[model samples]
Target: MPEVWERGADDEFAGRADDGSYDATARVVDARGVDDEQRVEAALRPKRLADFPGQPRVRDQLSLVLEAARRRDAVPDHILLSGPPGLGKTTLAMIVAAELERPIRVTSGPAIQHAGDLAAILSSLAEGEVLFLDEIHRMARPAEEMLYLAMEDFRVDVIVGKGPGATAIPLELPPFTVVGATTRAGLLPAPLRDRFGFTGHLDFYSSDDLAAILVRSARLLGVEALDDGIAEIAGRSRGTPRIANRLLRRVRDWSQVHGRGVVDLEAAHEALALFDVDVRGLDRLDRGVLELLCTRFGGGPVGLSTLAVAVGEEPDTVETVAEPYLVREGFMVRTPRGRAATALAWQHLGLTAPMDAPGAGAPQLPLDGEGRFS
Candidate 1:
């Protein structure tokens, strides 16, 4: 049986704070504390499931989850939201709290470096509360282990004294839902991953979805935008709502400063071009990688580090920022040898591929009679 302790209630948020007293519950009430730009970003975030654009499957599934919990009058099960950044994982977590009418405690995995840190937060959760843990994969190992038991049994053991003479005092917690968001789901341990009753994987939005998002953002920001303008910006938004909104704002600036105070097609094109975003959503850094591969590296079987050096960026940035979209759009390939350019990349850069270039419509080679490479 789980031990029950009636310690006085204290709410705790997972984000960093330097305070000894845990009496006050930390809340991400709004975007008020952040800079003006982030405040605007928050204002543009959709408040409900209906308003959020793209990721239909995730939306529908999350709707059912929230609806089922509502029908039962019980706290929703722990949910794991996995996706690339800027695809609305955090937004969806906030929306979940709104739809449930629950106060949310927001924090990130990196903030909880010790088991005690996680335990302190877990022990303070109010009944039926929602806890949004962002970048959950970055949490420390001991903290993660502590979280597993907490998620399963709603209890955490408070350790006292040194390891040899330590005693664990079990503390029972109220029923609360953890809404964890992670950019890299693969990094989560199997035990932690299995604890979540629901999981949502958000993919990049389509051009149409991005356009709709931009239109919604424009209305909220009071920007006059033509449909063609919205469509143009969306096509170059890198298939992300965050990027779409950012591009829309940039275009709005351009329209106000240079052209009429309206986001027209010309304004969208000129603004994006000035920012080095091409029509297909490839930015200067993206094109630099492609150009380096096709022109300098001869279509590249080059290592990521080598490529990054050539482009004057960190290897992680090259891999995480540029490579995913490039690979997704068929512009590049992660070969066993290394990163290589596809024929599409050459064409996109307005360059013809050499006859012997990788992915340049090469014919299949004949196999020997012994089934060996010819």
Candidate 2:
């Protein structure tokens, strides 16, 4: 008989602080969600893969995997989901379980600090259960190694007692599927990465896809939203469904408080303006980084640490959160030396890029053997 254990709640949405004030500068990569946000996101999430809006490629691929496993009357192969934050990785994990008609156990890498921690979870899983591991790249080394064995062989070797007198006890686990989610797939070791049979990389949502997501979310939230208002919010959603839904809620609040309880283009613009999100989806921290690079640094290559300090943010925050979107939008560039603002960045800030600016001149030489853009 499998032992019962508590399943950790999935963290998805970003929300207000303890003081009830929304944090516009929170790291998009962080998965910790406030209670209100978590509840609302759970309700907003699509229960099955067919209902999932965006990422058509991933949705189709996952459908095949689950359907084949169902026909075979066996657990599906271990699945890996990799991409930037807010791209529905967690939601996909839930959909996998739903499609398979199996119970899911949710936990994160940081929660499993020791091999025993992982062994316990594996031993407790019911046959054909889905174990959803969030942030799999951050799992402890020992735990990760244990996971490699468990994922491949459906067993864990539990070590008892101290180093010298320790005895290895092989614990056979029920056949189950592991669905791992990570924002940094590259950080995963080759051995562990190879254990997963199917890997799906989710891309940022298109504006049209985002608009479609907003329409669904608006209906679900019972917000009376106009088409133009939904389009306005989607355009400023930074290619993320999470941000789109969040912005929609903010617009709803603005409409109720300021307008006549109708989410229109005016309400969206006013709410987004109040929240410091510009027309280009650049937020306060994003614009701060651009402004510092173009004006303070003369648009030259500055070290990432220096650029982050200038913007009053952590290097990881600047790199993982703001930099991806900025570079994707062509407003910034990552050079061999460091970070540089592009001409578009300068233009967006209503400034001109100098001739010798990092991106304005000829291409920069590669650092070492790597490409110009590290």
TM-score of each: 0.86, 0.85
Candidate 1: pairs in clash: none
Q: Model 2: per-residue lDDT, tens digit, 63-170?
A: 999999999999999999999889899999999989999999999999999887888888889999999999999999999989888888888898889889999999
lDDT of 1 at 83: 89
Off by over 4 Å in 1: 1-35, 362-374
Report the lDDT tens digits of candidate 1 across residue range 35-81: 77777888999999988888999999999999999999999999999
In terms of lDDT, model 1 sits at: 0.89
Candidate 2 residue spans exceeding 4 A from truth: 1-37, 358-374
Name the best candidate (by lDDT): 1
Error of 2 at 8 (Å): 34
Q: C-alpha displacement of 267 in model 2, angstroms? A: 0.6
* Model 2 worst lDDT window (10 residues): 1-10
Where is model 1 poorest over a 10-residue stretch in terms of lDDT?
Answer: 1-10
